[model samples]
Target chain A: MNLFSIFGLGGNSHGVRKTESSGKEEHFTDTYILALVHKLRTPLNAARWALDSVIHGDDTGKEAQREILNEGYNKIISAINTVNEILKAAEMDSKDGVDLKKEKLNLCDIVDDILKTLGYLIKRNEIKLEYGDKCNPTIIFGDREMLDLSLTNLFDNAFRYSPKGNVFVALTREGGMAKLVIKDDGIGIDKEDMSHLYEKFHRGKNAKVVDPNENGVGLYATKKIIEMHGGKIEVDSELNKGTTVEVDLPID
Target chain B: MADFTNKRILLVEDDNFLSELLSKKLMESKANVMRAADGEEAITMVKANPKFDLILLDLMLPKVGGFEVMEAINADPKIAGTPIIILSNLGQKNDVEKGVSLGAKKFLVKAILSLDEIVDAVAEIIK
Candidate 1:
C-alpha cells in the first residue's frame, strides 16, 4: 500500500529502470566475456606448454615430434587470434580503457623477437618469407606488447591465409613515419569485403573459403594497434591473387 | 648413473591446454608423465603416488597456486626435497622471486623457453 501501489506497481521513476536494465546487461556480458576468454585460452596455453617442452628438450625428437610441433604451433596461433578478438571486443565497449606504457625500441629488434615465437609456424607451413628493412635502427615510442602483437597478427594472417604462397615483410621509413608492409600471395579479398575488412568479426569472403574457423580479428586488432600507436592501416587485395597490408606509425 | 628411464613426474598446471600439450611432450621423453589439472589434483596425485622423481609446476593454478603445491611438497616427509621447477607464463620479476622462495629450483617463462628447452630442463633436473 505504498508508492508502488499508487504508481500502478509497474512504472518506475526516471532513471531506476534504465540503470537496472543496463546493470543486468553488463552482468550477462561480463559472464559471456569470461567464458570466451577461457575457451580461447585453453588451446593456446596447451600449445605454449607443448612448445616449451619440445624446445626445452624435455621431449626427445621422436617420430611424433615434427607432427606435434606443427599441430601445437597452429593451435597456438589460433588461440592467440582468439584472445586478440576478445581484447578488441572489450576495447570497443570501453571508451577510456586499458592505458598502455609506451617505450622507445628498435623496430628490427622487435621483429626479431617476434620471429622466434613464429619460427615453428613458419617452418610447418613451408611459407617462404622474404624480409628486409630499409629503416634506420632508430627508436620509436609505443607500447612494446602491442607492437609485438600487431606484428604477430600480421604475420599470422599472412601465414594462415596464404598456405602455398610466398609471404613478404618489408620495413621502411618515410617522412618521420615508420612503415611496415606485409604481403601474401594466396586467396585475396574482394573489393566489397575490403570496406568492412577491419571491422571486428567480419571475416572476408575469401577468408571463409581459405579457413572455415577464421575469427576475423587479426586485421581489426592490427588496425587498432596501429591507431593506438598514432598510425594508420591500409590494405590492397584482389581475389585469387594476393593481399598487401601497410601500416604506418609515427616515430615519437 | 641412476636409471631415470621411465621415472614418473608430477606436472601441475591450471591451464588445460598447456597441461595436455606438456603431458604429451613429457610422455614422448619417455618419462611416464602424470598430469594434474590444478594444484589440488597435484597434491592429491603426489600424496597417492610417492614414486615421482621431479615435479614440473606451473605458477598460476586455480584453487591452489604453484607456491601452495611447493609448500605441500616440502611439508610431505615422503617426498621432501624433490626437485621442483616453476614453469609459467607469469614471468614477472616478483612472481619469479616468490616461486624461488617457495622452493622451486628454477623458474622459466613459457615464451623464453621452447618445448625443447623444457624437456632439457626436466632431464637435467631429474638427472
Candidate 2:
C-alpha cells in the first residue's frame, strides 16, 4: 500500500514530477491486479492439485480414474468461471458495465433450483435449511441467469461457512425494494475483512485458513451483479458467532 | 496389520470427497476417525472428546475457519493440550505462520501434500 511515487518521494523529485492523482490511480490498479492474480491462481491451483493427485495415486481401476476425472472436470470448470468473473469485473470499470438481459424472474424459482442442486450436501450435513414464507414467489426485474449466479454464490458461502447450523433465507418485498436476507449460524467473519469483502480478490483472514474451495472473486462478482441491478448488499457478522447478508434489489 | 489399531483421530474438513477419502484411508489404517466439517465442529469435538489421539485440522472451512478452531481448542482448559496438525489448501507463509501461532503443532497444505505424507506425519507424531 506504500506508494512512494504518490508523494513524489523517490521518483525524479528534482526535475520531473508525478501527478499525485495519477500516481494514486496507478497504485490502486496495481493492488487490484495483484488481488485478481491471486483469485485466478486459486482455481488453477485446485485444478493442478487434482491432476497431480490423480497421477500420484496411481489408481488404475476404471472407477477410481473416472472419479478423479470428474473431480478434475469440476475444478477446471471452476477455473473457467473464475476467469470469466475477472473479465466481467474488469468490464465493469467501463461506462457500459454489464448489459444485463433484464426480465421478469421469480426469486423463489432461482433459490429452489440452487437448493435442489445442492440438496444432497444440505441433507448430509444435517443443516436446518429454510426458505421462509416471505420467499413465496417474489418477483423481481433483473437478469435471471446473473441473479441466479449471484444468489448461488451467496447461498454457497452461507452453507460452506456454517458447520451443522441453520441457514435461513427470506425474500420479501419491502416498501419500495425487494430484500433477500440470508443468515447463517456458523463461524462469523472478522471486522477487518468487511472493508475488502467486495474487492475483486479479497478473502477474509479466517476464510483463507480453511480447506474449502473459496475464490475471493465470488463476493466481488456478486457485488458487481448487484450493482448492475442497482441493488445493495450489506453484511453483519461477529467473530465465532455468525454472519447475516442482506441483499436489496429493485422489484417491478 | 493395521498401522493405527484403535487410535482415535478427529478430522476437520469441508470438502466431502476429500474427507471421505481421508476417512477411508484412516479406517484402513485401523484408526477410528471422527470428522468435523468445519472449524466450529472441530473445536466442539475436541472439547467434548479430549481422548482423541490427534486432531487433523483443515483451515478453509464453512462456518468457523481453521485458526479460530485452533484458538478455541487452546482456549478450552479441558482440551487445551490437544495435539492438532494443521491441514488446509491455503499454502501461503502467512497462513502457515498464523496456524502455528494459534498453537497448531504442524501445518500441512492439502494441495501439494500426498495422503501418504500426511498419514506418515500422523503416525510419527502419535507414535
Which number leads on TM-score? 2
Q: Considering only chain B, report the TM-score of model 1.
A: 0.89
The candidate 1 chain A region of ten consecutive residues with least summed lDDT is: A7-16
Q: Which run of 10 residues does model 1 chain B get worst, by summed lDDT?
A: B1-10
How would you encode candidate 1's per-residue C-alpha lDDT over B15-104 as one tens digit per residue? 455666767667766778888877788888888986578888876575576788889988889887888888876665777898888778
Query: For residues A27-77, what per-residue lDDT tens digits would candidate 1 score against the true structure?
Result: 544433443444454456557655555665444567656766776777777
Residue A11 miss distance in model 1 (angstroms): 26
| TM-scores of the candidates in the order shown | 0.50, 0.59
Question: Mind giving the per-residue lDDT tens digits that candidate 2 earns over B9-127?
Answer: 99987766677666766776889999988777777778777468888987767668778887777777787877889886565677778887887778887656656677888987788
Per-residue CA lDDT of model 2 for A106-218, tens digit only, reads 87788888888667557766689877654567778898878877788888778877759999888788876888899998778898887667754566776655424555456
Candidate 1: Cα lDDT at A64:
59
Candidate 2's TM-score reads 0.59
Stretches of candidate 2 above 4 Å error? A1-61, A118-125, A132-135, A210-213, B1-127
Give the i-RMS of model 2 in Å. 5.1
RMSD of 2: 8.0
